[model samples]
Target: MVMITASGKGTSSTKGTNSTKVASSTSGTNSTKKASGTWSPPEFDESLPREVTVMEGEPAELPCVVFKLKGRAVSWIRQRDLHVISANGLTFTSDERFKVTLDNATSSFTLGVAEALRNDSGVYECQVNTRPKLSRPVSLKVLVPAARIAGATELFIRRGSTLVITCTAQLHPTAPSKVEWVHNSSVVSISGGRGGVSVHTERGGPQLSSTLSLAKVEMRDAGNYTCRPHSLTPASVTVFIVDDEVPAAMHHDSGVGRGGGCPLPALFYSALAALTCPALCPALCPALTCPVPPYPAPS
Candidate 1:
């Protein structure tokens, strides 16, 4: 025969015919329940941003917030190559630019990369040591803005004529604040000694354009013209001024032309030949009828 008794302390006693046994199985179970009920696993704060953007050559920081961390360790991993960058606020990568910082008060683990480059743009993961692990993904973007002229890399303009040059800058994922024009290594300004010089800028979404105009441009105004954007590569175009000796038709071309086309004055002179029709009319205008010249009287 066996008899069992239970007490408030979660202890149990069993009495047998030949022996008495006391077991505290329920006490162990209660202790386990209490411990589990008092502790919670780490979890990420979903309110924080998951995407970050920064300009090339600038610093980039990605933050991960985790609460109820207890004693769990945090790590940052680069998803591009599954490379471990840092763990428990200690850097593991060979790159000196990568660093990890933790704020105990806020429970934020931040991964910082100095002097970010275009190649550094990718998704990174912050992990907390837990069963199956708790992770949050963050994306980094590195932008590189560049500038280009509206026309060709070289321009030709007639002296004493209005010269206009338009420059366009592409600032992706960012808006351009301003564009500066440099003429022959000197910054161009409307208030400068060169009168009638004007610069007009307009913004259209991600592209910013600035037009430079010089009224009655002189030969001295010919040189390299560059459009420079803030912290970005500048674009340049060579400007050549034509003298009065060069016919207007010789220098006038679509902004992209290098003044290599056949001169209009030559075409005008050819048209005059068609009127005379001295056997050259057929070559100038195939549809024209040339009058036959009377053979010189047998002399």
Candidate 2:
């Protein structure tokens, strides 16, 4: 036979044919447990940069700083395409250009894009999956540099003719605020004299556009002229003017001068021909290298 007994204060039990006492008892008080330490979710840095500008072909960085992380995760996403770029300090994008670096000391999860392109200009988001899901939007702006002259690379005009050329630059509306005209690599200004050069800005286009004009072309203007603008790659235009001596040579006057042949102007034309021979000048070439001017003598 087996016997058992119970009460509010305690309990006991026994089992046996001879009443063997396999006893058990219970106490009135319940077991106690210690409370755990307080924990908080991660938070983002408030003073993060809202907009970042990086030049094209360079690397861009978007920072994601968190406080009191408590084992939370950080992630970066491309807002334009909604593609997950990085998660938990690991890169999720298959692109080799995308990477994530985590700094344990500063709790910074910065996303890096290498060799940035013009198409990469857009908004990106840095997110922390915390209790409230903290996030900060960072706008990435990519800048591309470009400049070009919109006309024939070289222009030929007769004396007393009006010469006009235009220069246009991309990625800037009024870039190169100052335009300068250079001849033979020497700075030439718009002198207040007859047949002078002048540069004027035209406001008809979105990008920056400037027009350089010579009111009346002359023999002295028959050299390589450079169109240089501030913060832009300079372009050159070679202006060739026809002289009366050039035509006389076509009429069996190819010999020496005054003996029924061309004059000094003919030598100038010949020099130009030799300098611009098909074997010398490439099809798509820039201005010729100017001979350095002689050093000025001390006064």
Candidate 3:
């Protein structure tokens, strides 16, 4: 017959049942924890944009994109000093030219720089704030209108000569580009800054003019000269110099009169006699052969 056990006698049976339930519950909790831990969140792809070119004094746009982004932040940094230019859809500093525009769906960010300067030429980096932090680097080169001398040219000066050459070119933004004299393509004799040279900018559109001068001429200074304009093409020209002395013989001859070598009357008579001989010799045939006067020899 089925009978209910008393509390003290049933203690061992209840204890065993409770222990089995506790073991099962502990195993279920451990399995659930492991499942949750195994699932990983999607990561952001931090990659910099490609194919970017900009001109000097013009606006530049740099694009940075983050793909598969879940909960990560994006940042833009200049490579020079790892300076943070922009971050997380917000500009940290109040620089008027720096702006960030984002395309939420495409996960792309664009950094705009207005009126780019020479200092803006460098590498830009894109970063994603995720585990291990994904990053990509891009290079930006700013091009200004420039001209340089073709390698086929050179400059020269003769001994005891003057050094004179012209370096000419055109530039953008209506400012004069620097013109420098490069010797052997290394030694910088004159540049835009202070020294024995100077640079002057005339108000004209994209056109630059400059001249290089050697104040005191020397004999040893004769050689090839190159005119290189700063950030522009180069032009080269040759120079020649000579000593000021005149030859002594040339001076002596200068004093002689045009007819000094022979008298005019003597010259006329000699011409007349020569003409008469051809005709008279035929007529004076036989014993009357004309005794030709030894025509007065040309004085």
Candidate 4:
């Protein structure tokens, strides 16, 4: 007599011949085959941008795109402090400036920061829930807008000469909205017959220039000139309109008093006269003898 025993279902023991019958069932199937029929694993889209840039005080957005996301959750973490900023379209940070948004059409999770500051620039991670926890790093750069005049803080332009001053505004990743010129606390105009004054602007990349031109600079044009970039700190330069004809008897070289032995600092004779002399130093600049060197034409 011959006997055999089968342990589990889908297995049959036969006593008649040297043969056994087995039935294939799902319970005995491979795990990979079972998973193949379920939802696909989440994968990050490599074609999307891996870095973001924005100007200070502007809104900044970083995107995280995934393929076959299914029910997986997406999160944004600030790498600077390893702080969780948002997860699954919900913000976890206390700061009201940070927010998360989800787009079902493109399977994207975006983190937005309003009024972005320089301190907000850093690496951020886009995380997706998975067995191993998949993540992608994205870099953020924030630039502060800086506006400045091209020349020195103080300038002297000879009367009847063309005065060309340029103000350059820089805001990396973006451009300044507007640039304006102010003369002696009054706004300068490019048109309306405003004393031959004109303004020209040009932009390239992150930097732009605004040129203020005066056809024939006169005494009236001498004063404080300010360049104001919209929503940015304004820069000012002291301007002096000097006469082309210098006094024959007076020689101003290193303050070596030649006209009447009037001893004055060399700074008084320099282009910085509007800053250090005439009004501020009346003792050194006598009205009759020293003659307060004809620097800025009398207002």
| TM-score, prediction 4 | 0.59
lDDT of 1 by residue, 1-299 (tens): 12233342234222341233223666677888999898577889999899999878778999898999987899998998999898887999888999988898988899999989999999999999898988999999987778888655656666789989888776644544688999997999999998999999988776778899999988789889998877678999877665534433333333212343333333343345535544563354343232222223232
| Better candidate by TM-score, 1 or 2 | 1
Instruction: Please list the C-alpha lDDT of all candidates, in the order they appear.
Output: 0.74, 0.65, 0.57, 0.74
Among these predictions, the greatest lDDT belongs to 1
Candidate 3 least-lDDT 10 residues: 247-256
Model 3 Cα lDDT, one tens digit per residue, 147-187: 54332232322344445555556566645455666544444
Best TM-score among the predictions, by candidate number:
4
Clashes of each: 0, 0, 9, 0
lDDT at position 146, candidate 1: 84
Which residue ranges in model 2 land beyond 4 Å of their true spot? 1-39, 148-299
What's the residue-level lDDT of 295 in candidate 2? 31
For residues 1-299, write the lDDT of model 2, one tens digit per residue.
13323442233322332244222122212221122343556668878887888767778888778888877778888898889888867898778998888998998888888978889889888888866677788988988765577665555566777778787664344443666767786776677455367778654443666787886677777788776766667887666665432333222323224453334333344454445553221122222221112233334
Candidate 4 versus truth, CA RMSD in Å, comes to: 9.2
Runs in model 3 deviating more than 4 A are 1-51, 152-299
